[model samples]
Target: MTARDEILGRVRKGVGKGDFAQRKIDAQAWLTARTRGPQPALAGDLLERFRNKAESLSSTVEAVADRGAVPAAVARYLAAQNLGTEVVMTPDVAALNWIAHGVRGTARAAADADRVGVTACFCAVAETGTLMLLSAPDSPATVSLLPETHIALVDASRVVATMEDAFALLRAERGEIPRAINFVSGPSRTGDIEQTIVLGAHGPCRVHLILIGTSS
Candidate 1:
């Protein structure tokens, strides 16, 4: 048998002997021993530190609610660019009424020449102005890719403290294992060739975030 198959066979045999529970207990004990310090509270200095870290990772953070015709603003921004009003919007964005803003929509990845892309962020980070979009049925991640310009509509309520917090939330939603999770910090950019930072090298060059807030 292959080495991998033999290893799996051995694991199966060991698991049949009820060793998995003992292993789990041992692992838990090891983890507890490693983290013996008391947990910090989520306020004041701790919160400030988290806020600072989040800002460093995010591109453009905004705080807002889903109300206030935010979708209209997204559409207006696209129209102003004379980009594709008939954009391939992410499924999350399609849930909103883009009709009010005079835009047709699709979920397909836009071509490089396409004018605009609209998407709803799964999370917004207040510390560093960043939006997080995860690929799913309603939010195809490719919508954020493949476009020249991308517009993200984020709700203030969805803002999180840090990437760690964001990953925790993602793990909760996806269980201990996930297929593909993409974390977009800002517009796709690279300064590799001549050390001259160029945007839209591998993905959308421009990223505009529309923060829909009940109280900014």
Candidate 2:
């Protein structure tokens, strides 16, 4: 037998494996059930809670009317921050005419020197002020990680009351998980040295969120 097969056989023998096909069927059934554990009681409006929590985490947030207005809002933010007009964005928002707003958009993974990276979040958790991002062909993980500034476009409708709710939505929509799932709580910070918090230690120093839709 091949080395891989031999190793697997030994492992199965030690573990006393039954029908592998049956085990896979069981796992699929468990996933489809969408079972959830206990979650904290989140009071008040979910959107308001999300905003408050995100702000507390030092993430800048803006409420825009709709998706059509996102490009203009993003442009305004970049100008106000004195950032450049060129930005790396995800393929999901490629159709938007960013050039009209004086911002050149490139749909690809972020590079080390990239100043700004824009992406649409899969969902936001209100309880912890966390952004749920699932890496896919259109949404790359590097867009939110390898940039000085990470700008996220989140639909207010996708904001969940808790982390549990977010996972439920993911299971319902995706059925299977993607290669990478990122939960961004705030700007990357580290207090390892002298217990002094330093931003951009491992990732973006700034995280800006543009909330869209009527609920926003």
Candidate 3:
């Protein structure tokens, strides 16, 4: 038989044996964490330090206080990159006035090459310095993935301590249901074979984050 058939036959045989219980327990243990520790005070100092560190690691890092607070930052970025008004706007971004900045927003279903993609983040992690996006009705999954340049507006209030914290928040909101959740760390990068890091391998080459901070 062919290699594919052999693999399928092995899978079928494995299923027939019903060896799923052990694996399930192992998976649960891997995901579940039981910990008791003192919670550190999350303050502006901490966030600024985190932002500084992230900037040091990454060549590109932009920060803002609120969603509405930084329309000029968006304009500056677009002007610097020379992106036009034809931008693919996701419904998730409610605060930013795209038209005011001379940007044409579009629904997720009808995004095209001419349009730059705009989307909102469900949560931003301060630990790994990543942005988390969930595939909800307003935040269509494609906006973050398809465009040549992706501009994400992250509210500082939504920024969490760690990836574990983000997961906890997600579990509280989503429950046990499995859905498309993307965790983007910087832009899309690949350093395979030749070992030279290259950006925009399968996704957007440029990822500009607008960190929108707010009072708690």
Best by TM-score: 2
In angstroms, give how far residue 169 of model 2 lies from its true place: 0.7
Off by over 4 Å in 2: 1-11, 14-19, 30-35, 214-216
lDDT of 2 by residue, 54-157 (tens): 99998999998899999999999999999989999999988988988999999998898889999999999999999999999999999999999999998999
Among all windows of ten consecutive residues in candidate 1, which has the lowest summed lDDT?
A: 45-54
Q: Which candidate number would show the highest lDDT if scored against the true structure?
A: 2
Q: Please report how far candidate 1 places residue 124 from its true position, in Å.
A: 2.6
Model 3, TM vs. native: 0.73
lDDT of 3 by residue, 1-216 (tens): 999988998987776544577777766787676663565556565456446545543525577766765566777788889986667767767456767876666666434464467788888777666888888788888888888788888777777887778888887987764478898777787899599988888887788877777432
Q: Which should have the higher TM-score, number 2 or number 3?
A: 2
Which stretches in model 1 have alpha-carbon errors above 4 Å? 1-65, 108-114, 174-177
Rank by TM-score (best first): 2, 3, 1
Model 3 CA lDDT for position 30: 70
* Decoy 2 TM-score against native: 0.90
lDDT of 1 at 146: 74
